[model samples]
Every structure is written in C-alpha cells, then in structure tokens.
Target: MNRYAVIDIGGKQLRVEPGRFYDVRHFTSLQEISRSDVNIKVSINRVLLICHGSEISIGQPWLNDAVVKGRLLHPCFGKKIVIQKIHSKKKKRRSFGYREQLTRFVVDSICLNGRDLKDS
Candidate 1:
C-alpha cells in the first residue's frame, strides 16, 4: 500500500508521498540548515490528512500527533513566468520575467503517534 499525507508548508498545502521529491517555496529555517552541508532532517507538524493502506486520518486544522519527516535537499528556482503588456495605439510595450526561489525536499516518512507508516 502507498502512504501519503497532506502537509502545510510556507502557507501552501501540498500532498506528498514517501520517497519522492518536491519543490516548495524557500523557507528561512531551511536556508539556515542548508548552510551546514549535512543531512538535516525536517519535521512538519501541520499535517492535514494521512492515508495508510485502508485507514485514513483527518485533522481539525492540523493533527497534533501526526508529523511528516523529510530532508531539505537544495535550493532551486521555479519556472520562469513571462509578462507582457501593450497599450492600444500608444506603441508602448513592456515585458518582464520572474522566477520564484524554491527549495527541494524529499519525503522520508510519515509518522502518526510516534509510529512510522512506511515501516508497515
């Protein structure tokens, strides 16, 4: 069975699975850890939901006993977004591009009440 969870990070909600990589907005805490150049474990407590096998758990706002564990891989950038603007009969044109700073995170395990679902 596959195990997964919905977690909140950087004001955004993400559905993550174990052994997979995800790019999320850069966090100040992650920035501090990345400087050490070591394997740093990150625990997220804002778990909205969890699914393991045939069982499911939901939280009211967040589950206090549920936690998602992962590793901060590295810093990266999101896809570039191009913006263009033009004025009618004014011959005025403007263009811009933007890329959001992001961090790569790999989900290692999901724990509920001190029990890791990946082991089972």
Candidate 2:
C-alpha cells in the first residue's frame, strides 16, 4: 500500500510523496536561510488532502490538523522561455526571455490529524 498527500504552497497545490523531490516556486521566507546540507525542514499546515491506502481525507480549503513536512534541497532557476511580441503593420516588435526562480524540496512525511505516515 502507498500513501500520498496534496499540499498547498505558494498558491499552488502539489501532489507529493515521501522520499521524493519536487521543484516548486521559491518561498521568500526560505531564501535568506543559509544553504547547507542540514535538516532545514518546513512543516506545511496547509494540506489540501491526504490518502493513506484506502482511507482518504479531503479538507474544506485546508485541513486544520494535517501537516506536510519537507526539506529544502536546493534553489535554482527554471529554463528560460522566450517571448516575442509583435504589432500588426506597426513593425514594432520585442523579443525577450525569462526564467522562473524555483526551489527543490524532498518530502519527508505526511501527518494526518495527529499521526504521521512512515517515510519510505
């Protein structure tokens, strides 16, 4: 049996599992923290939903007692995407590109109510 959880961070909902890494939007609160290979973890209280094998719990916006724990792995920028803007018959055009700042995290555990599922 496998367990999974849906967590909300930076205005997005992400499906996460234990022992896996995910690239997400950078959090301003964590940016100032010195990067090190330590236990720099965060407990997110905004869990949207949780599923433990056969049992499932869905929250009304967010679960009050549910929490998702994660560790900061790294901070990086996503691949640059080019944007081209042109005006019809105006001969005015602009080309630019930008990369999104992102953060990587490794899910540590998912606690439902008061119990935590074992991290694999």
Candidate 3:
C-alpha cells in the first residue's frame, strides 16, 4: 500500500498521497511561501509529509526535517452552508452562508534525500 505523510493544518489533519488531491484548510499568509523558500527554510515548519518506516519523529507543525513534494492543482470551494434565523412576531429574517477556501495539492512523495528527516 502507498502511504504518505499526514500533516496538521488549519486545525485539520490531512493525509497526503501520490497522485491524489486533498482539500486542506486555508493557511496564513506567512505559510504561503514559494516552493524555493520552503525548501531552504526550517522555521516555517507547519506541514510536512514523511515516508513511512523512516527514522523520523515529527513535532507539531514540524516533521523532523521531513519534506513533502507536491503539485498545486487548483483552488476549490465546498458547498455553502445556509443559515437562517427568523422571529415570528418581529418579522425579522436573517440569511447567511459560508464556504471555506481550500488549496488542492497532489502529493508526489515524502523523502529525506535532500534533507535529513530524522536525527540520523
């Protein structure tokens, strides 16, 4: 079976796998860095995908130096949830809806070839 690293983002846990797309929660502007910067930067460790059976121990947001290579497919939005509130006598009605923005990414692989993923 194919396995990929799962990460926690936007208060949600995501499992990333090859040739698969996932809808992860929106990240802050600081986390939206270029691929090049993400490769070199270590402090910006919030989400990472590491291979299984690897000698790696990842902390919250940091995957012990593991890295997940993925491709951006597109931004997609889920169905909007409708909310309605009404008062019988006051004749006041409120309607609202909300939908979250998500980023679609296809996980390529989790590896430590370029970077050390564990305390090896």
The 0-to-1 C-alpha lDDT of every candidate, in the order given, reads: 0.86, 0.83, 0.58
Worst 10 residues of 2 by lDDT: 30-39
**For candidate 2, lDDT tens digit of each residue in 5-114?**
99888888899999898988856567554555545788888889998888799999888899988888767679999999999899999999999878888988899868
Model 3 worst lDDT window (10 residues): 35-44
Count of steric clashes across candidates, in order: 0, 0, 0
TM-score-superior candidate, 1 or 2: 1
The positional error of residue 14 in candidate 3, measured at the CA in angstroms, is 1.1
User: What tens-digit string does per-residue lDDT give for candidate 1 at 1-120?
Assistant: 867999989989999999999999855564454445645678998899999988999999899899899888877789999999999799999999999888888999999999888645
Candidate number with greatest TM-score: 1
C-alpha lDDT (0 to 100) for residue 118 of candidate 3: 30
Clashes of 2: 0
What lDDT is reached at residue 52 by model 2? Answer: 87
Summarize candidate 3's per-residue lDDT along 25-69 as a digit string, tens digits. 665544454434422212124555555554444556565555666
Point out the higher-scoring one by TM-score: 1 or 3: 1
User: Alpha carbon lDDT of residue 22, candidate 2?
Assistant: 90
True-structure lDDT of candidate 1: 0.86
